[model samples]
Target chain A: MVSVGQHENIEILSHSEVEEVAGFVGNFKIKVRRKARYVTEDLCTGCGLCQEKCPAKKILSEFDAGLGTRTAIYLPFAQAIPRIPVIDRDNCRYFEEGKCGICAKLCPRGAVDFEQEDEFVELEVGTILVTTGFDLFDCSRVSQYGYGTYDNVLSSLQLERLLDASGPTRGKIVTRDGREPESIAIVHCVGSRDKNYNRHCSRVCCMYSLKLAHLIKDATNAEVYEFYIDMRTGGKGYEEFYERLQEEGVIFVRGRPAEVVPHDGRLVVKAEDANLGRLLQVPVDMVILSAGLEPRRGAQDVAHVFGLSRSADGFFLERHPKLGPVETASNGVFIAGACQSPKDIPDTVAQAGAAAAAAMVMMDRGRVTLEPSVAQANVRLCSGCGECVVACPYSALQLVEGHVEVDETLCKGCGVCVGHCRSKAITLLHFTDEQLLAEMQGALRVLEVA
Target chain B: MPEPKIVAYACTYCSYPGADLAGTLRIQYSPHVNIIRVLCSGRVSPELILRTFREGADGVLVLGCHYGDCHFVSGNHRTVKRVAVLRRILEYAGIEPERLRLEWVSASEGERFARIVDEFTETIRGLTPIEQVLA
Candidate 1:
């Protein structure tokens, strides 16, 4: 991530989102809304004084998975690109009551600008790469997991922050009360591979659960119980790592836990142990729900803006599953990472590389070969009925001087307008009426008689 | 009768590649069906299907991308409405409506495409030839 930010050719538009996209692939006009940071980019030295002096605090930190609090003006993380802090205007006291302005006074470089407004930037680009990553599925939705009901039951991401060296707990495996956990229960496939929620298998949970089990065991030597439906370690050295975790005394229970309930001030994970052929109730101080990766909240909005299609599982669909994995149906717009599907870091990196290469290929060519099978309008036969104009999904057909005209550049050769043309003015070039009739006749074995 | 000849019209973006994937995966289905690739399933007009049946086709299959997943956005939307009306016309014309099937098959659904082709071919086999229906 730092390397991408540091790249000379790369311009990182941090805290910005695509507002509008227009034009075709190589000649796209993009409008982006860069959210207000309230801090000058060039003037800020990224000094920690302003963050420490900010009076408004206790706002739930999004970076910490809501497990920790943050000040009004603070960087999202320690290694944030550009090292600039964004002011949470909603939580800032100065914005609320117009009294506190300690962050501006404490800034050695005077970078804080409370009056800063959201800026919109319009750019012309040849190609685009959409790498909007996945969001962890809300474990609370699976009510049986008792995620919100039990203080000890936490999502894998929250546990990740707890285990991080610079995280909220400063790398401590403990319960909500800050006490070292005597035992931890890790449940795999929290919302994945379940018919009720998501029918697809989240490909990364099993291995990550193993890694978490290993880390928790090493950190506190807690009796770790792994509840899983299947231990899928498909990657190279992944199965070996799973074996190593087994060697490290991690008790692997092959079963999906039925429910997590509070018994006596502690969470009891009730599950049917498939190997033992009996039910087991394991009491643990901390429970980690290995939540599945899902498409981001506004993924549909993003897909609409980019002219991309989504699969049944809600991730952005690639042009082809095998041959054109990084490409989309939309020309020059590529997708990578978990936005395409739930994949691990290694797979994400590989896909990101492929997407970059695909974009580069388009940029280097400086031209696109238009599809030959585009719709063509016969002005002589046109009646100016304007039905084709309304039927065209691409808006490529128009009535020019009382005659239908086809914009070859925008036409995707879908032939929808041809189907709706009452006057029979429009004809898709390759799939013309004559050509299609010949093909159909050939298919029906009637061409010989005809 | 030498297995009934079925003419299947598949869109280039989704169903055509889906059929190719079935071959790549080596999933065998009925050999009676011949696939003709069009730019979009929306291109398969009611006239085209009726003419194919009039010529000699025992069955006609129209395949496109799943809903909201069309390469040409809303192309399959038009295909759905067109096929729905065309099925009624087929039934009124004394033709078996089941002989003409419209289905959504994405590029990734190779096994599904094979299964649909096999199932549709079996249905066509159960019915009399298009010659008998026209007669």
Candidate 2:
């Protein structure tokens, strides 16, 4: 996405899954399985004529807020690059009954092709950047907020869409109960700033909450009350914006709301105004809970997949926060977006650009010099217990046919595999026993020379 | 009579410059200490530390930028963890882990670097040689 956005020479094979990454820093061969979208990209006009006539229309639109419905054969989103609709094989009437070819018949450019199978592709790249972004904190986990229970309680992202002119309600500030709210309450730090959930204060929520408050007030002329622990708008121009919202007559309640209860066809929010040292009950027709950012589910698996390290907060670890913000400890791999940390859109974009630049520099160089301290396999020592393979954090070692081969690029030189090799088949370059011992002996010679 | 040998591994960003500062200031400590610079104290692997012991070094000192001052932000965190584990490994091997030391020294700590070397050299002088421990 970065290279393409930067207008660089980039060929993106979409719907591709990387099966294997082999070789080292400057030279890496990646095996990918490109799943056939069953539609020819070059011919599809994206006219939506076929979609209108499709019989199956009840499938959940994953891209939508789930507040909207979509047809079985539909485009992923309006702004999807290819702009071609994908036929959900499971839901397509012809696939289900071997009878209907309505979509194929209706296609103006004859783009649908069911016979397309998954094809394997191999590419050589100097570096790989992983910017697999983050999923929103699931407000369903905080059952006390009545998120899934009450229709009016929506997550911050859902509220974002609700207020968006392009969203399900067409920018109308109406509750799920189909009523325009007279009073709206916004809760801050749903899954964040709490040790039991996410310990870190999700960096963007406070300012975004303020934005929502202003938007809601502007949209519905409703009284807006924001319940927060502290309005941490410390970033550039953020404090001034917070002040602007306050001056705009948005009520700022200094407290983390204790409980949200549905009462008398409305929601009652009970919280303490910590600054005022008083408990108060606020009633509202709509509630927007500003949820926090958590490490995406399977973040550990993704880390394992890319041979990256995650911090205590489960965000991918950067090589150096100051010097190498986008680089990971594992060479050839970079991190960006909320995968590294909870960041606002601007920071995410900036980090994404940095990650792209790092990849571009390596790509432009056409080769990267890997650390010399990579693990090597001694073919003569032939136990092949495969213990070292399991021990390798980077998946650098693999048993091919019978012998083990070390992908020098993938090896991180941690030496855990060397320790695990019972057959003494592994050696770490540069930090080999001989070289380290020599350095040690040279250091110790100070005693005798003095 | 020869001075005791001190193998100092200073992280590149901070402690290495601190040692350099000590040299530039002409703050004379034991000339016995020889320094090896690394990217971070976290980069000072256990293999390197144990090899130093096996090769007959009398003392080893691992110094980093400081708590929260790591060039990699939490790179020193890994250092703290690895050093703790290495200390346990040394103790299990029947070697006194005290011979291996981990310290947080910032870029400005030239005088402190001299003091640390002086104090550590004296400590090594009081103990039996590392060869005796290995034997």
Candidate 3:
């Protein structure tokens, strides 16, 4: 991530969104809205003094998965690219009550700027690649897990922070009471492969659970129990790692835990041991819910901005599941990572590389050869009532002078306007009225009566 | 009764591939349905369906991507509205509305495509032929 950020040719827009997109494949005009950081990028030398000096420090750090507290002005994480801090406007003392500006006073570089507003940037690009990854499924929605209500019921991400060397506990596997856990229960498929939440299997949870089990054992030598419906270690070397975890004395239980309840100052996981056909409740010091991955919250809006379709699972739909995995129906636009679907890090990296290659291929080619199957308007017969303009989903048709005109680049050859044009002025080439009628007659010529 | 003749217009981006996948999977559906590939389901004008019925076809099936899954953004949206209106016209013309079926079939739905084809063929076989309906 740091290498990509420091790339000579790449200009990273850290906190920005594509507000508007116009034009076609080879000539796209994009408008990006860069949200306010309230800190000057060039001026800030990434000194930790401002963050250390900020008075408002109770806000939960998003990068830590809410396991640690952060100042109002802080970097998302220790190794964050650009190494700049963003003021949390909602939580900043000066922004709220207009009293404290300790961060400004403590900044040795004088980089703090509370007056910053959101900036809009325009760029002309030949291709676009979308890798807006996935969001962890909200574990609180499944109340039976007792995630928000119980102190030790941590999501997989929260556990990740606890295991990180730079985390709140400094890589110690401890429960909420700041003591090393005697036993830990890792619940797999917390919100995945279930009809109630998401039916799709979160491809990475099983392996990550195994890795977490190994980490917990390494850190605290705790008795780690993995409760899973199926142990899907399908990737190369993943099964070997799972085997190593088994060798490390991790108990694998084949059942989805029904619920987690507090019992005698500890958490008890209720689950059926499917292998033994026995119901059991095991007491544990901590419970880690391996939550599934979901499409980002703003996925629908992003799809609309790019004119891309989403699959039944709400991820950005690829052109073909097997053949055109990285490409979308829109030319010059490619999708990668979990934005396309739930995938592991290795798969995400591979897909990202493929998407980059696809984008580069389009840009390297000087021009694009569009299909001849675009809609054409007959100027003489066109009434120009603008009916087709409204009917066109791609906004390809427009009223020009007294006739309707087709923008060849924008038209996708759907021929929807051909039906809306009362005067029969518009014809989609290749699939025109004559050709379609002939094909229909041919299909019915050999009909057998019942 | 002899097998009914069904002409299915399938969008190339989705339903056409869905039908092709059915073949790849070796899923058996009634062979009475002959599939024609179009750029989008929106390309299947109301005139085309009426023409197929007038030409004595037993049934017409229009298949496209699911809602919000159209390759052309919202081509299937137009297909949905047009098919609904056309079905009403068919019912008013004394033809069984069951003879005209519009379904969403994505490229991954091979089994669904097969099932729909088999079901539509059976439905058309139970109905009077287009020539008989006209008479």
* Retained true contacts (fraction), each candidate: 0.63, 0.19, 0.64
Clashing residue pairs for model 3: none
lDDT of each: 0.89, 0.80, 0.89
Number of the top TM-score candidate: 3
Which model is ahead, 1 or 2, in terms of TM-score? 1
lDDT (Cα, tens digit) per residue for candidate 1, span B1-135: 657888899998889988998999999988888899998898887788888899889899999988887878788888888889989999998999999999999877889999999999999999998898899
User: Which of the two, 1 or 3, has more TM-score?
Assistant: 3
Model 1: per-residue Cα lDDT over A1-450, one tens digit each: 789888998899999999999888998899999998999998998888888988777899999998999999999999999889998889999999998899888888899898899999999999999999888889999999898888999999999999999899999987888789999999999889998888889999999999899889879969999999988999989999999998999999999999999988888999999999999999999899999988899998899889887876889989888889999988899999999999999999999999999999888988889989899888899999998788788888888899988889899899988877767788899999999898887766642332
Can you give the lDDT of residue A112 in candidate 2?
83
lDDT of 3 at A437: 83
Name the runs in model 1 displaced over 4 angstroms.
Answer: A94-116, A378-380, A383-391, A395-407, A445-450, B1-8, B15-35, B49-68, B74-135
Among all windows of ten consecutive residues in candidate 2 chain A, which has the lowest summed lDDT? A1-10
Q: What lDDT is reached at residue A387 by model 2?
A: 71
Residue clash pairs of candidate 2: A24-A409, A26-A368
Query: What is candidate 3's lDDT per residue for B15-39, written digit by digit as tens?
Result: 9988998999999988899888899
lDDT of 1 at A163: 93
Which ranges in model 2 have alpha carbons more than 4 Å from their true place?
Answer: A1-8, A95-99, A370-430, A434-450, B1-135
